[model samples]
Target: MFQKIQRFFDQMIVMRDARGGTEISLELATAALLCEVVRADHSIAESEIVAMEAMLKRRFSLDEQALDELMELAREESEAAVDHYQFVRLINEHCSFEQKFELVRAMWTLAYADGEIDPLEEARIRTLSTLLFLSHSDFIRAKFAAKPE
Candidate 1:
């Protein structure tokens, strides 16, 4: 537990690259956001986890071992997070607009994975989309794109 906390906090490390700029783990940031949405619904749906695993693999090319590790780390990170700002900030710093749109789409897919959308889950995605600076049109587009048929 304590070790997990350590690893989670390590994702916040501020490091200078060769050009003296801050760099953070975009993977950790992304997974942490997924963890946030999973918990927001206040129910542990296996379907959400499954959807998230597929989305992460599709987006980042993660294998099973890597996915497991990331899920564990993200679980801890999201539990420790005071707000979504930490994860959103990382994404905004490292991700392009299209990347952020894909994340929003992925989140919508998770929200719909259990054959329904929880109010809290919807709110979480909206907040994340806003923080990502995604336009209302794009957010709506992604929601429609990911909504369960």
Candidate 2:
């Protein structure tokens, strides 16, 4: 009986650690924020989704299956989240200034994917860019850098 109890305790410890494990990387968190930006306008257009998938694949060097899996996981988490704090906290903890700037660019890229950036999308990007500690200059730079040619 004591051995069974000990085994149960050990299992509990393992489960606790596993539950606390980091499921999303900084890049994935950034991608999730961009996903939120794209969805902010109440329209997830095919162009936006395609641009997001392409960006994720190129930036992360992920194969199609891996990119799809990441997007699915990110979508689930982003949808389940109540606010942007979870993503902001992850970015704060794991990203550098340059990386954050790049994330903003990625968000801009996703926003422009539909050919016109909606007002809500712009607002969301501005709010999230500030939350990510990007300066206005950096934000503008990112926007230009991600602009479609």
Candidate 3:
């Protein structure tokens, strides 16, 4: 059975519109998930940071200040959290499948941005894909979309 959700991905996606109400935030949850992937290999890379910032700006239309704030909040949340349930719930609620596809692609991008895929990073993506309810084909597609040549 699916768990009932009470929140959204912030005002950006607004999972509350017509469907429900806003209970939390937008960038915070998504960014936390990205932060998790960054920490997967236990070493943050310059390339991964660059890729994440670039994608966040493009996707959320966040300026420098907002981007920095979001990243900081995400880092804090990721550090304090023991699981991915909250972030995954928000994404599944607020984002469309296509959006989730892009998000998964972004995860893959961040994972390989350092020009290598650590097993831990790969494992996180795999587990996250399932939690996000993404199909196997979509998962493979997203991986290929962000894979380094």
| Winning candidate number (TM-score) | 3
**Cα distance off (Å), candidate 1, residue 97:** 0.8
Q: Write the per-residue lDDT of candidate 3 for residues 1-149, one digit (tens) a residue.
A: 01212222334443332223423365677888888999999999999888899988887888786777667767887887778877788788878888888888999999989989999999999889888899899989999998777
Please list the Cα RMSD from the true structure of every candidate, rounded to 1 decimal place: 5.5, 7.9, 7.4
Q: lDDT tens digits, residues 1-149, model 2? A: 45743432343211111234535555556667978998899999999989899888887777676677668767876776677876787787767898889888988988989999899998999999999888888888988998889
Off by over 4 Å in 1: 1-24
Error of 2 at 135 (Å): 1.2
Taken over the whole model, the C-alpha lDDT of each candidate is 0.81, 0.77, 0.80
Ranking by TM-score: 3, 1, 2
Supply the TM-score for candidate 3: 0.83
Candidate 1: residue pairs that collide: none
RMSD of 3: 7.4
Q: Write the per-residue lDDT of candidate 1 for residues 75-99, one digit (tens) a residue.
A: 8878876777767876888788999
Off by over 4 Å in 2: 1-22
**lDDT score, candidate 3, position 6:** 23
